[model samples]
Target: MAVPRVLILRAPGTNCDEETAFAFEAAGAVTERVHVNRLIENPKLAEDFQVLCLPGGFSYGDDIAAGRILASQLDRHLGDMVRQFCDQDRLVLGICNGFQVLMRLGVLTSGVRETQPATLTWNDHGRFEDRWVHLAVDKTKTPCVFLKGIDKMYLPIAHAEGKFVTADAEALKAFGDAGRLALRYTAADAGQASDEVLPFPSNPNGSEANVAGICDATGRLFGLMPHPERHIDPTHHPQWTRRAQQPQWGEGFAIFKNAVDYFGE
Candidate 1:
């Protein structure tokens, strides 16, 4: 099979590039870390990549609100490229700060521009929270290339503004009804354990809707306030007490593997 080329977006104050790229490489896909400026200067660069990943980090120091500056630049420079990506059914995965960027870019909503990208906002709690949580997968309707027919999976989350809110409540409901609610926090051992929604220590962020991640109406794009790259190995978890019991393939690693394999196809 031909290797899938993944683009890892980089910007001022953005971190976690190496880890995200490493995760993708481990998942069996070719990866590249590129600055947003490069893509802005040449939108055609993205044409060569099957996946675009906005990895976690405080871009522009998270100044004037998380992901605000980066989102504005992207809207101004690469908005057209983004639209074309969506039209092609290419994948866009935003984690943590990247999630904030996607939300601000309006890739998570459903309305006049719903089928494409929508918006995401701050968590109701109003504080930067970091921890893992379980997530329930509503796979009936989600058509995201990264999460095709997989059920659930665990991905550690670290962020203060990881909550997801939409201007239109009815649309959100319709999204769920259509099986577009990609990921939701749930009690531990709730069958959807891979979602990181176990309980207590697992549900760290306290997000509204217990939302760990979400997809747009079309599901080609995805945004989640989690750090799948953080937990690629069993050692990444704090639960040393159960190290022996931990599985060989940690939860976070699986998500990347899934993405790589999906794009590789």
Candidate 2:
């Protein structure tokens, strides 16, 4: 198989593209940082890559909402192209603000309804929160390619509207039942993860059902609020020096590695 090429999509105010590109390249994949204008001008540019990633940042100055403007641009100008890209044997990932974009674009929850069934809203505390969080994955529920070998991750999250909420209880249950609820925030010392929502720092944003990330029915598309790209190296951890053992890589590195490995299979 050929080397997997990743497209790191960026828009105005998108600050995390470089870090995201570096993570992908380090994971043995080729990467290119493409601006939204360039893609809108020529949607065919998407065909050159096997992976599409929307990295973090305060896109459009977070006006009207974090990713609303960019999402509208894609919906109005490049909707069909994006749909085709997802329909093919490829993968899509959205991190931080990128996840907000995917949520607004309705790509992460595709096929659920004509309108988005879930959304990332304001933090329950009504303030921006920036902190390290422990995330647990639901391996049995989702076939998400990026999370193939990841059981848990310690990642940093910086956002004000990173809370995940479904339209209703029925929708939440439906997504959980179908395995679309792929990741959740959990206590650092928690032995086995549960659906019960954890308290303030543990759950961070107070997201419903403790959701920190989610995937689509196909599991090829994923969106998460935490910045995995920020933690690809062991030193990225806040307390690497105090650890009893330092691993070769950070917990988040597995995500990029898994994405690259998917092409090999």
Candidate 3:
């Protein structure tokens, strides 16, 4: 099978594009870091890639709101192109700030009108929080392409406005019923994943339903708060040195590997 091509989109404060590109490359995919302006100049350039990734960072200094500026640009200048890209059986992954962008662009919450049913707002603590987190994938739901073969993950998260909340109880129920709520924060020792929201440092941001990530109805487009790119290697783990034994790669590596394998299949 031919190797997949990944386009890592970056903007003025996107500091993770290089690491994201490296992760994809390590996963056996060809990757290129493209500036947002470059893609706006030639929207057709997106057609050449099998996967589009939005890595974590404070784009435009997270002014007004995280990812708002870049999201507006994409929505106004390249919305059609991106929607078409999704319809073409391609994949889109957004991490951290990128997730914020996708949410603001309404790419994740499709069919919503002028008001989004859900949004990522400031943490309940009203401050930036950065730390490693435990996450569980919702395999019972429509499987997310990026999360295929993954049950749980230990990844790092860094953000101030990362709390996932819905407009109301009904909307939250709708998302759960649709199986779009693909990932959630869970306790490190949790046996079975439940909707029960864990407390601070466990749930991390007081997100409704403990949501750490979500996928589109089709499961091709995904956005999450954790930084998978930062944990592709085994040594990236904070406790690697104290481990009795270690895996060949970190749990987060599988996320990118799954994206590349999706195309190979």
Candidate 4:
């Protein structure tokens, strides 16, 4: 068995690097926080790690749009390296802003030329959304490595442009047929959750199919709007004090463990 090494890639506005790194460390994997510029200076540096994580933040101050500037940098400079990383069966995890970057990197959605098949756009709310959300992962539909053994998760999401959309019927069918939709927003209780559609607060940015996260065609590349790193401890639960028996760890911690275990397997 091998210990997984995670590269928590960061940029000027990346605020969640420490927490994301800590989560991986807590999950028994070695981790590093590298700046995007440093990686751009040497794109081959990515080959040193087993996992690439684009942690959450207001990258480049979310100027122009969230994750756009960073995405452009990767697309123009290290796209091949990243594609090779995923193609090699290595893992890529994108939280919030990281998810935005993955969308533009074509890690989650691919196509010819500028004719992209899917994208994350402005939230239908027309403002920033910062709150916890209940997420449901259907293993039958998604082969996501980070979501193994996860049925329901309570994580926080903070982003304004996290809505996912695709106009092409073929593209939508492809995503469905391939089981690319890895996660979705659900009710506080999983049993009563709606399928494919939910209103604001429940659906957050109004992502079609209630999608809160998606995996690439291979399922090795996974990105989601929610912040799993924020909920590593039981205290993170909103109703922890009201529980009869408190769990030692938060629901989100399993995702980190799953990432590390992927390499262990």
The worst-scoring run of ten residues by lDDT in candidate 4 lies at 187-196
Pitting candidate 1 against candidate 3, the one with the higher lDDT is 3
For candidate 1, the per-residue lDDT at 118 reads: 35
Candidate 3 clashing pairs? none
For candidate 1, lDDT tens digit of each residue in 68-92? 9999999999998777766685778
Q: Which ten residues in a row have the lowest lDDT in candidate 1?
A: 191-200
In candidate 4, what are the lDDT values of residues 151-210, reduced to their tens digit? 888899899999988867667667766778778898776632235578778888888878
For model 2, give the 10-residue run with minimal summed lDDT. Answer: 188-197
Q: Residue 169: error of model 1 in Å?
A: 3.4
Superposition-based RMSD of candidate 3 using all C-alpha atoms, in angstroms: 1.2
Q: What is the lDDT of candidate 1?
A: 0.73
Query: Cα lDDT for residue 74, model 4?
Result: 86
What is candidate 2's lDDT per residue for 1-265, written digit by digit as tens?
5689999998899999999999999999999999989998999998889999999999999999989999998999999878976889899999999999999988888776676689999999999999999988987877788889778889999999998998888888888888888888999987344689899999998899999999988889999999999999999999999999999988888999989988999
Runs off by more than 4 Å, candidate 3: 112-114
Candidate 1 regions with alpha-carbon error over 4 angstroms: 110-119, 192-206, 240-246
Q: Would you give me the overall lDDT of model 3?
A: 0.90
The parts of candidate 2 lying over 4 Å away from their true place are none
Q: What is the C-alpha lDDT of each candidate?
A: 0.73, 0.90, 0.90, 0.86
